[model samples]
Target: MNQPRPIFGTTIFDGSQARKGYALNRMCFSFNDAANRAAFKADEEGYMRSYALNEQQSAAVRGRDVLGLLAAGGNVYYLAKFAGILGLDVQDLGAQQTGMSKEEFKARLVRQNDQPAATAG
Candidate 1:
């Protein structure tokens, strides 16, 4: 059987690295100041809204649904644009979740959390 196609958000790679995975034209944003990060974290939606994206674009941010955005004819470029507008440091986010990429880590975390804990013998 054919393997499922990977999406843009599925794997965390630097803008340059991501290009190797067919994620070209994606923009990367970086914030060095902790205060800026905190501010962005405080209200990501508000920060994204400040970008002045149209109704469809606004829905994409509000949903946090990458696939939805893609389904709506948006590509990695647009999604990365959204990330930039929201003040997200894509490179940092990708770097923070190292080893096996962010998507793999997220899946692992979900699987580990869902499994029942082993009892001591």
Candidate 2:
């Protein structure tokens, strides 16, 4: 019997999600090729059509919403390529997920790095 999975506010990119996002992931993977990225930049709608993305995926791509993409079955790793097209790195996406501005997120990271580890007496 298949058990219902707990999603704790995040989509799990398991086999079912993989199948659901195959076309979307494939399209993002194509971005690894410069020409394909150029083609997408030239005509976003046309590029999406070639990939046969469903409405949800299409909207997510158009909005560049990391959470939206994840809800639309996007695997974060693959979606990183899509994010790159918008000049956003993983840190930017992490900030978006955490509702922090880029500078705030960077500062938080710096703070964590500067914190001293607890020592046992």
Name model 2 segments beyond 4 Å from true.
1-8, 117-121
**How many pairs of residues in model 2 come into backbone collision?**
0
Q: TM-scores, in order shown?
A: 0.33, 0.86
User: Per-residue CA lDDT of candidate 1, range 1-121, in tens?
Assistant: 9755776455433544343423211211322445544654677666545544445544645765454444434445545655555655554344332435666666766887999999999
Model 1 backbone overlap count:
0
Range of the 10 consecutive residues with the lowest summed lDDT in candidate 2:
3-12
RMSD of each: 10.8, 2.8
Which regions of candidate 1 deviate over 4 angstroms? Answer: 1-37, 71-121
**Residue-level error in angstroms, candidate 1, position 79:** 3.7
Candidate 1 C-alpha error for residue 82, in Å: 6.8
